[model samples]
Target: MIEYDSYGRMKYDPQLHFNQGKTWVDEDIDYLIHWLEIIGYEEMSLALGRTEATVRDKVFKLRKKGLMKEGDKSKRHRKLLGRCKDEQAVNY
Candidate 1:
């Protein structure tokens, strides 16, 4: 679903368009990766306007940089698995 303006107009927001395989700057990546340590992937994706895979990739990069811990073997212990990637990202 699209976003409805205050007056109820559905304006086409450019951000809703999921630019897959897009390149990101280090600033956005670093900030998101920092939060990724504290938040789940899906929520972090929403906050950073990226896909869950993008957030995962960021986390993986953090692991490579020694910023985050390695080892996520079980979804059984995963946090916030109930939440999903935002509908806007899915719409793309």
Candidate 2:
């Protein structure tokens, strides 16, 4: 479940913390990055069942680890889509 502050920003829900670093299937992570790119942070948070900060943090971490490109739109889209497609192919 999600908790929201009075200002409507997603609040850090302790219950959701366990979902972090828990190893999403590649399709899930790809879907996350794709949604973040298309719809932006707030909606991404909803889709990810995470706080907006967590969404931003995860994306940043992915970039830091070189799993995602920082600013190259085409590269980002390809990487993200490729991840999803790979997962689908492998039935993961």
Candidate 3:
């Protein structure tokens, strides 16, 4: 259940929070992955009102910690795409 403003916008409903002074929660990671699958990472970042890198980092960290099973290929693909864009940008 997501909270929505009167204008049909999602409100600032944070599923993730710092516990005992700044710690990542598994549930939060799971939630993010779930949404990422549905909306993609960029839109998930927008919906979370966070930067794209932040969201990507969270996924990466979780994968490193074994808190996530997916995203390995996605991460690789993103990096490859980034490199391609950078090369293209330089040539242009």
Better of 1 and 3 by TM-score: 1
Write down the lDDT that model 3 would get. Answer: 0.50
Residue 92 CA displacement from its true place in model 2, Å: 35
Q: Write the per-residue lDDT of candidate 2 for residues 1-92, one digit (tens) a residue.
A: 44445544556655544465456668767977666667766656656666767777788988888887665455332221122322322111
Q: Which stretches of candidate 3 lie over 4 Å from their true place?
A: 1-27, 72-92
Instruction: Tell me the deviation in Å of residue 16 in model 3.
Output: 17
lDDT of 2: 0.59
Error of 1 at 62 (Å): 2.8
- Regions more than 4 Å wrong, model 1: 1-19, 71-92
Mind sharing the TM-score for model 3? 0.46
User: Sorted by lDDT, highest first, which candidate order results?
Assistant: 2, 1, 3
Deviating ranges (above 4 Å) for candidate 2: 1-8, 13-23, 71-92
On lDDT, the stronger of 2 and 3 is: 2
Which 10 successive residues of model 2 have the least lDDT summed? 77-86
Residue-level lDDT tens digits of model 1 in 3-37: 43343222344463254456877877777756655
Clashes per model (N, Cα, C within 3 A): 0, 0, 0
Q: For model 3, where is the 10-residue window of minimal lDDT?
A: 76-85
